[model samples]
Target: MSQKFPEVQGGGSLIIAWQVKEKNVLVVGGGERGIQVAAGRILHALNADARVTVVCPSSGLNDEVAFRIAEKQVSHIDRNFEPQDLDAADMVLCAVDDPEASTRVWKLCKERRIPANIADVPSECDFYFGSVHRDGPLQVMVSTNGNGPKMASIIRKKIAGTLPDNTGAAIENVGLLRKKLREVAPDLKDGAKRMKWMSRVCESWSLEDLVEMNEADMSQLLDYYKSGEVPSLKAIRDTQ
Candidate 1:
């Protein structure tokens, strides 16, 4: 099967959210640079139950890789990479310092129809890693499309500083409200009615209000919805 790359818009790279859970990931090289890339992949995979394998000569293995190996978080092959290493890999990271090896890995991955990321070699990479900021269930990623990684990091830091600490909590409360709505207003299952009700609820409750709500407040909100009372748009606007 041929791989379909995402379309570029406005001369910028296309951004996407990929699901890597339970997938096989291959990391070639275990030096300082390679360790950094592998560490990120391992962290992302930890919560998703994905499998990660690192291949690098023992002499090139860094302390970080050694520690992860000792902890049994990822499987490792203490030797140089081989062409067959690309077999069964859903994603591959080529971080070796040798340009020849990196090029070979990239070519093999392309032949096998696997997505590959070659560190510092955007031309040979299928994708580039972006700077990510995660807050509980909320995750924000910033990417410069391999044009400027340092700028992406700076932007990520700026955005992370502006987000409220309770942002994640607010999202969780909204989720709870959604579940209650399904039970309390089953009759409002029609898409329009449901959307309007949800809009009212969202407007009536601010992020701070949602984060500060207790069990009593949640029960009261459910009762209000069950009473089939829709707050007037004027009232919603006034709250805003």
Candidate 2:
């Protein structure tokens, strides 16, 4: 088991939020079960603005995979995996039922130093797609390294349940407010001041209040930041 999962030597893998935008992702296979895995990876890549190429027999494709190809959302190869497929691939996702084929893909990916995930074969995977909860720009991922996937999912749900439903909107509004604040105080020397002011604002506002914050409220907040003052709740509401 330790040989199968090298990370066991050091607790677990280090989790990170990878940026795959504009990168090429090679997806292989679309068998009955493979279809689900392929479709998921395809959608996730597209969501990250990554270029996707699906390599699978036409008959093996599921409705979702076929629909994506029909809509020109991704390029399709309509054939089995080939060594050349990894030429420009930043990553690979193999979901074929044939263990040999999956292993071959993993070997090629390793040769090229490209990360790969072979469905249902955690031993060959360079990465794991753990349970994730996404809310606008906020994403929380729960990983159990390759063990207890269902447990990871349950924990993810409990974590998500603890957050307010509108938490995403609040975060987005705060991000926008942060941009406006930067514009109002763009001097490099004021970085610490800006951070402190933003921290104060975040701590003082409720989730609902942050969600309802408008351009006027942001402008008033900037005024307070500029004057080195922290606005009271009443002062913030007066702007509305």
Compare the candidates by TM-score and give the number of the best one.
2
Q: Write down the lDDT that model 1 would get.
A: 0.77
Model 2 C-alpha lDDT per residue in residues 1-240, reported as the tens digit of each score = 566864535768979888999999999985688888889888888978899999998999999999999999999998888999899899998888888889999998898999999988999998998888989988899999889889999999999999998888999999998899888888999999999988988998888888888887787777778777878656877766
Model 2 misplaced stretches (Cα beyond 4 Å): 1-9
Per lDDT, the best of the predicted structures is 2
Task: Score candidate 1 by TM-score against the native.
Answer: 0.80
The per-model lDDT (C-alpha) reads 0.77, 0.88
TM-score of each: 0.80, 0.91
Give the range of the ten consecutive residues with the poorest summed lDDT in model 1: 231-240
